[model samples]
Target: MDANEDLSPRVMDANEDLSPRVGMEFDTLKDAWEFWLKFGRQMGFDARKHYINKNMNDEKITSKGFVCAKQGIRGPEKENMIRTRNQDDTRTNCPVKLYVSLVREIGKFKVIDFIEEHNHTLHLSETIYMMRSQRKISKVHARLIELASSSRIKPKATHKLMSREACGRTNLGFVELDQYNYLRTKQQKNLIYGQAICLLGYFQEQLTTNPSFQYAVQLDNVK
Candidate 1:
């Protein structure tokens, strides 16, 4: 029950189908044990001090006090190279593996709470759609301005007089004409209108959980 002790046995029975190979070599139990001990020491886990001297008590994974080796299971790298590969594309394994990876990279306490908080709900598809749509709308707005300015054939006489006078005072009329020219482009106007509608929709979706309102539960508060 030592915290550092292999919890694989508790999690997996002797006759369990899943067999975890330590690394690239050593398929047998004795070899695997020796390799693990040696590797642990090399990676800075002292067997005599960690296991023997400390006389560490059984510490389950759920307990906040427990601490284990940062190195957890590696994916295909841990499998025996010589054995014919019977690769199982484990769907359940993905989240757990990600969780462990996050815990090791970040800290276990924060990650555990993050998982618990986000366990049941996280609208990934909706989030992605929102991001994509927002990008598309921004692109449309830029294109509209570019196209409108390009379509300007000639300037009005009044615009020329105003432009000359304004040039002495920082050319405000010329700048306004340039903007008007861009805004008059047919393609630009069309794109602007289209993007505006899309943006409205995205904002409507965001408004559901936008601080004051709540349509779905927010995961940010969990951590």
Candidate 2:
């Protein structure tokens, strides 16, 4: 058998079911990084940029990525509030990493390699809030909130429904309180803007249809 065939099986064994594959391509390094950042959050890890390759013009050409288990107090730390010599305060040394490269011919950045093994145990729940991306509301969730708001659902009720939905999903990594606040804030702004636009349109229609009617409003002056 040739060396290439022999090596292929070994590589497959190493990756196993956890084999990492290339994902979507992007036109810019910033876009690529943002995508991976969200992807990593979904996968229950924190993503970091290890390196960046740049051209003479200071343009990003390629990038390296790495992921580590969210760091926090270990099991032993939870048992004992006070620190001791035996309790290790250091973070886990997770080995998962990846490489991304820009294909100049295609004008896109692609994930080139991925090392999917981790050296430490990962938290099942708390990892969701470790990164900012994970805590933020998703576009789909935002749309759901908008729909609920349009239907005259109370913000608190909408929050409860969204929280229940999130709880049922194994992949979403968001805090219920945080998600509620985000949805509420967005809904308020959208409602205010929507009302203003509707009122403006009504006034314009009235003025256009009834030219003889003079509408006046008093304004409070403030320094």
Per-candidate RMSD vs. true structure? 25.5, 13.5
CA lDDT, every prediction?
A: 0.32, 0.59
Cα error, residue 120 of model 2, in Å, equals 1.5
Backbone clash pairs for candidate 2 read none
Runs with alpha carbons beyond 4 Å of true place in candidate 2: 1-18, 21-51, 69-90, 106-113, 123-136, 143-158, 165-173, 180-223
Q: Residues 182-203, candidate 1: write the lDDT tens digits.
A: 4467557699779977977877
The residue-by-residue lDDT of candidate 2 on 1-223, one tens digit each, is: 1323211100113332343477646677776666556556546566666666677786656565545533333576454643544553444656676667778788787878767766665445545454554455556666666787689887667767766655632334444566568767886988987997797788888999999866665545968
Error of 1 at 42 (Å): 70
Best by lDDT: 2
Model 1: residues with Cα > 4 Å off, grouped in runs: 1-155, 167-181, 184-190, 193-223
Clashing pairs in 1: 1-58, 144-188, 148-182, 149-182
13 Cα displacement, candidate 1 (Å): 85
> How far is 21's C-alpha from truth in model 2 (Å)?
6.3
